[model samples]
Target chain A: MSPRLFRSRPARVVPAVIVAIVILAIAAALGWVAIAAIATGGSGDSALSSGFSGFASLGAMTWGAPPVITAAVIIALLGLILLVIGISPGAKRNIGYRTEAPEHIERFEVILPTSALASLAAAAADSVDGVSSVRAASNASSTIVTFSTPVRDNDGIRRDVDAAVTQRFASIAFNRTPTVKVRVQRRQA
Target chain B: MRRMAAGANRTGLIIVGLISLGAGFAALAISFGLAATAAPGLSPDAQLQPIAAVFALPFSAGIALVAALILAMIGVRWLAVQVPRKDSAKPLRMQEDSRSGVTTVTANVVAAAVEDDLEATPEVVDAQAILRGTARRPELILHVDVDERADFDTVVADIAERVACNCSQALGVPLSAVGVEIGIARSRQRRQRSVQL
Candidate 1:
């Protein structure tokens, strides 16, 4: 492929290429050992010795032009992969959590409770001091809140959510670690 | 250092795991092919032999599969990281309003000192106060809980005098701002927190 494709987005191609190199290395080692053993009439020691010796005397083993070109291509592909991974020192995580909870519950014949997991989560969230308001997702099990006055983006709000979720979900059979999102908002001061 | 650790994140560690897993699978597949070839009965073709299959299978197909599997691992990790960010809500937090050695205080220190000096007045049976208004000036809202037969005006007058004496000599807060009010004539047994202003 073009150099632009790999450079612009290394995440897309690096894993594929790394996997390809691993495949090629295993195939080469197997091919060398098996071919050597057959040529030496099932002698395991001779086959093993020759596999290493072959790489040591790289250009000495005679092969067809097509086979040689294929090997070259494989080697170049492996090199490109190593380069990409080396440059990308670490991984980057984008924000947010997404979970799917049940639609309805049948707790001791109290069927179809319109008041859902998300609604309770919102209520618990509102109880927090710095929290201005909470707004859950359309899916009742999922809750998202607008913090009318945010203390800090992830630190303050994230801690409060963890506590609030534990308190609110304490009573239900809908046992889950509910995802808590804190969005900063402003109220009329 | 903390920022660097955060930046390295979950995705980077996942990539490392994927590469290691890919290498392991490729080795296993190549070894399995080698084992098959060492036994001649499994050979499909005489000339193009079982040995040829061992030599070629790993390079042609097995390596490719391992690479694709590693890419799939990356995708799976990415999905795992996205779920929690979308589900946040209003959370609780705390801040220090003032840091003068106390974690929390429900009473004014200066007002408490003034109430101590109010005890000398004989007619002032009970007294309570609070720092009120926008300036938080100490105001005396005294509750002289009198008996049914006692003079209410006489008791209020004594409490007022006590508050004035304490203000000028002890607290130095203006005596004019110290307004006293007679609350309930109830006993102290049923009362909550009360401070003499």
Candidate 2:
């Protein structure tokens, strides 16, 4: 089975599929009208004669017409949106871990998702003495840990939780260490 | 991770976007009389009859037919690549000499063995592996879920030093690349059958 080891960015499949379908529709319509016109020798009585006449009448509309201007603006806006999607690099998904491989190993990469890192931080903070529970949230560069404790004297517990969580992260040896922030909240009786 | 035509999608979007932008801008330019200097006949007040008359010609149908076919092909190709792919490597020939008996190992078999080996580790709850590249220069990609309370450093060290090393020895070749992704499992679901005294 295949494993999605790293988070991938959006592939813009929706917009691409939409554009493709639109192109297909346009192609079908154009082909139909062209084939009908050719088969009927451009006769006015043909079924597709109205479609041809519609196209011919479009030439009568001035470039300054409101409908034409509105369509041009919409098309331009859509083009801009697609251009941005194609150019943007999206977000980073993985937190890299430092690796020291043996000489025989040519390449080694280790990664952990932000969610897992947060879980690890929460577990570490919870293991500290006087901490009743822990919640953690992490991003690429930082982790925020919140602890709920029954103890009245919060200073010592806060320090201990900070040290424990920081030490836990240090042991993992990430490629870039995320700064740890600790918040202690007193539990209600 | 599953393979996707991300590059193709980006390229297609860019091409389509440029064309749309060009058409829209050209229309706007003509509407605003910006292009009147370049072609007096294409003024903002000018009727589209001159352009529409081209379609009344005999060859216009043939041109439309060719353009329709090209657009249809592009659309079909774009639609086809929307499906995700695994792109796994083929069976590898592990034996050095084909003249004697040959040893062939499928990627799935190697990946399964690696998964089992990873699960045997103390804190690992679940694991998945994919073996890629040639036999002589094999690559291992893994996803491991470990208990939140487990020692992350020890688990990672075990994978690099023991599991990967064992696989390399079994295949009689050094691993060219190894990528391990770690996840945390909040709950332990694996049933313990034996206790270590």
Candidate 3:
């Protein structure tokens, strides 16, 4: 197996499950109608024959009938929605890291989720000497670190927090280094 | 992470979508009298008796039953694939020559050993591993949770150099591929107790 450097997209499980259920339901209905028709020997009053008779009533409706047009429109829209879901790639769930290994051996690919990256950034920022508390959020492209301190001299503390978070991210060697943004808030001691 | 039936889902969606789109468009076309040229009596106001009359045929019930069975099979297959799969390799035959003796190792056994080794690493709170590929070209995939403040680079390097080398040496074959997924552990609840004073 080769290394997979790219992030994996989420499987469209919900849509797939729904579609499968719909198919099963349709199959069940078809089976029921077929059985009813077979048992009744295709009599006019049989469920399947009656079902068709009911459908034949729709022939009385003009092409411009509200119900006919609405059903057609709804079916078309449902198909369009399914097509879109099938084509669209879902959200990426992890960020790949650059691998560093000896040339003779296969390099190990590393990955981290955005939530984990954010936690790492927050931990690094919290460890900064003057930072009393910290919060961080990360995406594929960037991370924002926000820290609150009870110190009046916050400029240096902000820089230190920024450096700490940046160093942590650098050590991970992410394939695409997310830019770090730091914000500091001051509180009375 | 386990493998998903994404390809199957996409294919199913595409097939269903095309059928639905075609049916809807055909209905719309007939409603608008667009199909009048092909079937003269087909119109929005046309009696559906002619269309529904096919079901009244002698063999229509058998055809419907067959179609239902086919649809049911498709539905069951789709539902079955929803279960996640690991797709791990089969038991590895590690013996140099089968004439002398054969040694077989299950993927789970190797994966468990790798997980134990990973958890032994400093600051790694939890670890999971899966071994794939043949014995000659093995692949290892690991997911490890380490303390947020742990040195990320050192831990990664340790896995790449030490853990992988140890596994390769044990198997007597160099790993063809290795994948590590790192996560941050905020809680110390699962941390290993090194010393009990």
Candidate 4:
């Protein structure tokens, strides 16, 4: 990935929105509760006292009721979802690998997009004999090339495709060379 | 720092949300008579006592302060994450003159020129350059959009070579790092002629 693309992380809009809404709701609730406490002179007379007191209590919680258990489960599930979303590496835009420049060149890096890699791989695989068509998918770690050929020996085509792709990848000075895999199937007559 | 803040933002929000959500649901559940039989002796009025007492004294103010701080923290991180950052470092000296005043240029200016030059290329549709680090040792971030049919490798190499050469000789500064991102431009649709009868 380009350092610029990686360094300039995209804003987590969904998470940010969730956080904003939750925080605002909680802030509003706290404000209301605090106001109610002050309005009632901290007396046990306020209507919200029941909810507030229950929350403030540090004693062991009674978990006998079905409604309480159900509510707890739902809330726990929601929290788990949020935690997963927050902690997990979310969807990332495809940015290609950072490649080393040619020898005797000044310090510079070229980021080749995954699309470009796939294109290059497909082009290389297409050059092999008996390969009717080629489709390739690539990322920073690996490239998978699948081709259809009408030839008798699919295995030979696969090997040829693999070798061609390997050669192409070897020529590029990628920060890390991706493993190449080739799949060949006989084309339908 | 931005990445760290981003991670913290998510963690903090999820943690706080879980606590608040759990408490709210628990209170509602108890009110609805779920597991209400377990605490046969406890009443709705009774639960309020612990909370009221906690918020009655200095603890009330403290809770309020903490709540405000949490809200502020989430809010600030959300805003901070939205702003794009280019790493800042030392400034590069462009010229040194004994009799005349010394001349200097920021990495940003060099990057802008490079961006403009790249965009001027026939194959390139648009480009942006973000300069990072100090003046003497700058890192260039080049993002370019090229004609979809253009030769991807050749265009990238051409842009890199041009930018590196231009910056070194023109700006007289050695770059510490350079990174480029290339995007294929969408094909333009041809317009149809309108006929007036």
Native contact fraction per model = 0.00, 0.65, 0.52, 0.20
In the range B1-197, model 1's lDDT, one tens digit per residue, is 00111123324534544554455443333333432465643222222223333433323333333444554555455434433231111221212353544342233443455455444555445554443321223333332333322333454444444455554444333432333333223334322433447
Top model number, TM-score: 3
Candidates, DockQ: 0.02, 0.46, 0.45, 0.15
Error of 1 at B23 (Å): 57
lDDT of 4 by residue, B51-137 (tens): 446554544643664586677576665655655456544456656653686666666677778888887788888888877666555
For model 2 chain A, the run of ten residues with the poorest summed lDDT: A42-51
Question: Candidate 1, residue B65: CA error in Å?
Answer: 68
Q: How far out, in Å, is residue A76 in model 1? A: 53
Judged by lDDT, which candidate is best? Answer: 2
DockQ result, candidate 3: 0.45
Window of ten residues with lowest summed lDDT in model 4 chain A: A1-10
Residue A23 error for model 1, in Å? Answer: 63
Mark the 10 consecutive residues where model 3 chain B has the least summed lDDT: B187-196
lDDT of each residue in A21-71, candidate 4, tens digit only: 667666667766656655655543434433355454433333444444566
Q: State which docking tier applies to candidate 2.
A: acceptable
DockQ of 4: 0.15
TM-scores for all predictions: 0.20, 0.77, 0.82, 0.61
lDDT of 1 by residue, A81-131 (tens): 544554554332111112121111111011111223344455566567676
